[model samples]
Target: MAILTIPVAYLIGAIPFGYLTALWARGVDIRTVGSGNIGATNVGRVLGFRFFVYVFLLDLAKGFLPTYLFPMAVARFTGHAVPQLGVFVALATIMGHNFPIYLKFKGGKGVATSLGALLALNWVASLAAFVGFVLALVVTRFVSFSSMLGGLVFLAVYFGRVDDPWNQEHLAMSVVTIGLFSLLVVRHRKNIVRIKQGTEPKVSFRKKHPSGRVAWVLIPILALVGAGAIYGLAAQANRRSELRLQPYDLTEVERVGTGHQRTERLAYADHGKLLAVTCPRYNRVVLYHVTKAEQLEVARDLELEGKPVAVWTTRDRLYVLVRPSGDERHVKPGWWRAFDLQGEPVGQPVPAGMYPDDLIVTADGRHALVLTSGRGEGDPKRPAPALEVFDLGATPPQVVGRLEFDQPGDDPARIKLSASGNYAAVTLLGSNQIAAVDLANRERPALISRSNLEQSEAPHLTESKDDSILTATTPDRDAVVIPWPKTVATRGGCIACILPQGAGLTLIDAATRRLLGEFPLRAGSLNLGVARPMGLAFSPERGLLAVATRSGSIHLIAVRDRPENIGKHEHVAASEHLGRRR
Candidate 1:
């Protein structure tokens, strides 16, 4: 089905609108007319400007339709859209325009068709090329020269603006751009020679008739004004549609503490009625009661013996992991403390590893999965970064299973379980990898998949910070479940992984382990600016995702389940920052 688009696009482009229009209107072959070319320029020179506009639009539509519509049709049938399909369609359309089979493999120079294809592929690059074409035409009054300049500008802007030139996603498009540029140069070789020899005919705006001359001058001025008005209206409509289509809205941004304190983890419990935020800077676990209006109100703060690193909650219990303060060399074993909903201690602090970062409790509350990054010094027996599974039914929750990472400084940051508690996903900050574990066998959890975020197709995951002070003090990576709502037809859910180095969220399909998409945390008009998003929590009942940033503010984003809004939301690119870590 995808391969058929190329031939269809070629056939559509093969329809020589200029020749058909001339034959139908004046009963003359456009190929035997002025310039001996059946292009819009020749049609206008032989007939009039009106015929030029008609034929140009007809030609443009042929290129635009295939490039824009085929990929969508293919995606609807195949369940996945191949972006490279558009590049093939674009090339086939241009090739057909340049060499129409009906015309004995001879056709126009493909300038107009290429422009139409470019508009469908990348609008920004197309806009830049059009502007260059207009500027060159105004200066030299040579249509051929302007067309060549536009192609060059298109290539320059397309390649120059990409953040990662060698990205696999852009490889096919890059090859297409170079091919199109070469085609333009080869096709316009005769025009180039004529221009160099000073024998090329220049386009003249002046007309012999008085009314014709006046019309020419007024038409351009009015066209510019009309185009500007249309562009303004389109931009306004796009913004309105974006607001309506977006699933989330930033309702409130409540600061956790003094606005300078770093908040690490967040967990919602009691069916989204209670919120727990672990603040390591203040050495306490702050609890918030979620109001009916979706606003957070201070419930209570549980002061701990050590700095609280991570938090989790069950139906009637709150679990907090605390680690000792100061340098890694002097760091001692951390503890996991349990409390009731009212902030009262429920059990004695259980001794954990040297540096326990995050944990998750099973649905039945029979087991607890803890992630510990053993980076502490002065202890040769200090356990390596590992995922420890404990039997919660046993006294003191004894460790029943353990899976230690082979690398020394993997620095596993966060761990989260699937909705059914059958699988787990962990983010390894130090190694720049995300590991998926199969928890179907509770007694023996097994590593199923491991993906390096930096090398993955997910965009903006390569950027990393180098400031050791920030790295040591702040919580950087997190993973939260975007549960599939019962209201929506889709059966499976997605995982939103936050990469602090990139300051964006990478969405992965939980069932297939495929990367769905990546989007920046730029809440444009809502002003919910996120910098180094440290923690995330999702409420299935309310369809809300709470993001806790390092700057000490919690953002509540509502998730929508409307079928129309599933994959239609716009994805904005995140701005790049300098630096990298090993």
Candidate 2:
């Protein structure tokens, strides 16, 4: 019953309203015509602006329905209140719009879908994104550029004004929403190329078509039906389950810095005896000695060539990713350096991709994997999404092999290596796919397989959203989770719009190079917080998994225990407040 919700939501979002509208209005495939896109923009260009508005609203509904209405329906049918499940449904809806399985896994740019989802998830941020889009569109007269800029604005506004900006509560949601911006930027790569070549088309405001009556009638009918179905499900859910909001216990919460500097990344090193945190504004890695009692004291700060973005540590060495400073004209495009345990330079700086964001070192300290985002700074055409493997056994860990992807902006963002270093799994953020490489053979790493994290099955209309009443069998004990609602509220905003789920983690079999499964982390979990998993470190000695969430806290999970037994400890650079528990 609980599992049926995501797939059902995906199917609902998979409807190609724009493409269908264009095909019905005129006998032309929207993908083959202007812009070669099936989005509302392309549909509008082929048909008319008035028709485009209809398609846009419908596309937005695809995103809105699943997040706003589907959750209540699932909760009603399953008799279980899964609040964080809405995040999964919302993401699935956006994913369906971007990569609809029915379209042979080829879909739109997802700007409209993401905007709609954002509206459902955070109206404030959605409004910001909308404003950015309109302003940029009016100024540039280019939808592609405006959409990309709008996404960036959305990120800025979301992180700036949403709750406590630097807390762990918003970290996971921020990471996920930022990924939406990345998706938009990556998808619009070709458009950027066209703009640079001075060949991009400017949007034209055309008149409305006279035959838009069908769309108007159909859209209203569909909305009414969707609303009624949602209401019915809500009644069922109300009768079955009661919302039980439990409180999460925090082990300890302490401020890190002076609240002036931002805490970017946290890592446990020296066999979990030392904690390394990257504070970019401070332009240094602050080392802290962790006592057996879990108390942290400032050890020292290692100043770097530039602002540190990420860090990886071995038995006796530390690796840092730094973005060159503006005045440092001598620094090359590559960025990464190695240092000894005492914070001494190991040798020369290692050459990496355009923008290296994440890195991981094997337990044996014999190999290291670096994800170079390849998306060059200041230039959209300079995408070099690549994975650089280094032989750590070498004097300064020489770059042994480089693995590149065929996709233009398929940047390997988050990377993880197995405990034994037998295999490496990388999340290609741009494509919503994961790639596994056989790292057993260090000299020549082999690409094992690439799997899309998102489900590949195309969503199909399973039931009528306008179904006024459900059959008696639907109330049966074994009935599947019905997706429609009896009544959907027409109010100020959506319920989940202001609420978002945390980031999720998926497991991959290191030896087999296959994905095991996905596990929901933050949000709806017993841990009532958001987790932006920046780094993963497994300590076999302590039987604990140390996760460096890009926030003010570090989450520790017992490898041998259940998820509910996991704990989150907040520690910032601020030493003024210590030993505080929440």
Candidate 3:
């Protein structure tokens, strides 16, 4: 389905609006008219400026339709969004306009078509390029020279602002931009020679031609209005392509377990029907059954051979990390053991680093990542904190790669994989930073970027399904949710950071890294009625956020409301509580 978009784009772009308009209006072949080219400029020179406006707009629509709409339509039909296909679609549209099959392989120079495609690809760069074209024409009055200059401007501005060259979509767009710019220069070779020889035609508005005067005044205004409309459409398309956080009010559904048991982590399996909580102090994992009515009921407890630090769940298996308990803690190595959903051991334990605290499995279930603090108890030589990667398909899961932190006290706490499963974000508690690790090479994971949170003490981290946002818990009792740095920038504003300890969650704009807003976790000053909120999990299918606190209570918050419904719901005052379990 995605592959079919290319040919469709070409067919759409191949429509010769300039030639058709000339034939219908003046009974003349636009290709044989003045300048002997079937383009808007030649049509205006031979026929009238009105015909040029009509043909240019028609040409623009052909490029815009395929470049902007094809990827969106493909994504709607297929479950996955393939934005990289837009680049190919844009190139095909321009090529079709430059060499239309119906015109015997002869067509326009593709200036208007390229502009329309560029507008869809990146509106800011497109606008800048348009401005460059207008300025160049105003100075030199040479349309051909301005068109070539505009193409160069688009390439410069587009490539300059790319934040992530490693991103798949960005890389594809870069290649296409270079290809289109080269094509533009090649097609305008005769124009360049004419300009150098002082034989190129210049646009003129003589006193005898009132239509030229009217065109000089109306074209800029029309272009401005058209650019504004295209910008709005591009913004809407981008919003639809990405995942957005809906306007939600938290409502505590139920408090399932007792307090003070030190519930360290939570994992859901069996399609969100089973919830597993790890209790290191008790050396066991408590399994809960979530009924159809959304109530939690304890099903059973699985006792482990050692203290359970964290638990991860797949479709049919449960992996539990067990650390040495009592005096042997941090001295003996920890191990991860796999079990069936029934809590029966399936394979021999795989030895991990000393003081292993967290584990995350890849989307394919072919690899697992374990984060170990590597803190040695009174030993002269302490193992450096590291992220251990394993190949799960092996007979005995073997360690394929490892990433060790430079400092021994980095004390990495939690690791979370991005939506694409090509990257992982790790929280360095002792360093107050978050490390973004590239997992493109599964066997040789590399640290790509590290962001410091200044005074924030990082502990645990979670990511949105689209990898657009990352939320991390701070020991200061705040959950900081920031846009993932790798994502393209969108609408954002500054949010004031409120330091009322344990009061709420903080929102930060990923582009600026400034505080956005704080969402309090209290129902009329009642609080979550728990202290030290730690683990956080968002269930998109259920639209519920399960927050595990050290106080041993799980607070289920409803975040189900769509963004468009925000206006229908009353906005509660800052002093008032939003919602809570009654």
Question: Per-residue lDDT for 482 in model 2?
Answer: 14
Q: What's the TM-score of every candidate structure?
A: 0.47, 0.41, 0.48
**lDDT top scorer:** 1
User: Could you give the candidate ranking by TM-score, starting with the highest?
Assistant: 3, 1, 2
For all the candidates, what are their Cα RMSDs to the real structure? 18.8, 22.6, 21.7
Clashing pairs in 1: none
What tens digits encode model 2's per-residue C-alpha lDDT throughout 1-582?
556878887877787887889888888899898987889888887897888898889888888877877768877876766645666777788888888888887888887878887788778768878987996786567999999988987786566444244433454466778777888889999999999999998875455433547667766776787599567645532331111111111122222331213455656677877767776655778776666655556777788777787788877888888866554523345568877766778888876657676777778777778877655323455556777788867776688877776564475656655545667666675566667777767767778888665433111111223322111110000011111111211111001000012243333222122332333334211232344444444443443334443443444443332224222221111111211211
Worst 10 residues of 1 by lDDT: 573-582
Q: Native-vs-model 2 lDDT?
A: 0.60
Candidate 3 lDDT, 1-582, residue by residue in tens: 989989889988988889999999989987876887888888988887788788888888888889999999989888667757888898899889999998887999998998898788888778989998998787567999998889888876665444333333356787888888888889889999999999998877565535457777778886897699667645532321112232444455655543235566778788777778877666878787777777778877887879987788888888998898876874688999998877789989999878887888887899999998775222437688889899999989999999988754487776767768888877788777778898989889999988885554333333354553343533333232322111222222212122435344444433334333444442111221223455655554565556665545555555445445444222222112222210
TM-score of 2: 0.41
- Count of backbone collisions in candidate 2: 19
Worst lDDT window (10 residues) for model 2? 471-480
Location of the lowest summed lDDT over 10 successive residues in candidate 3: 573-582
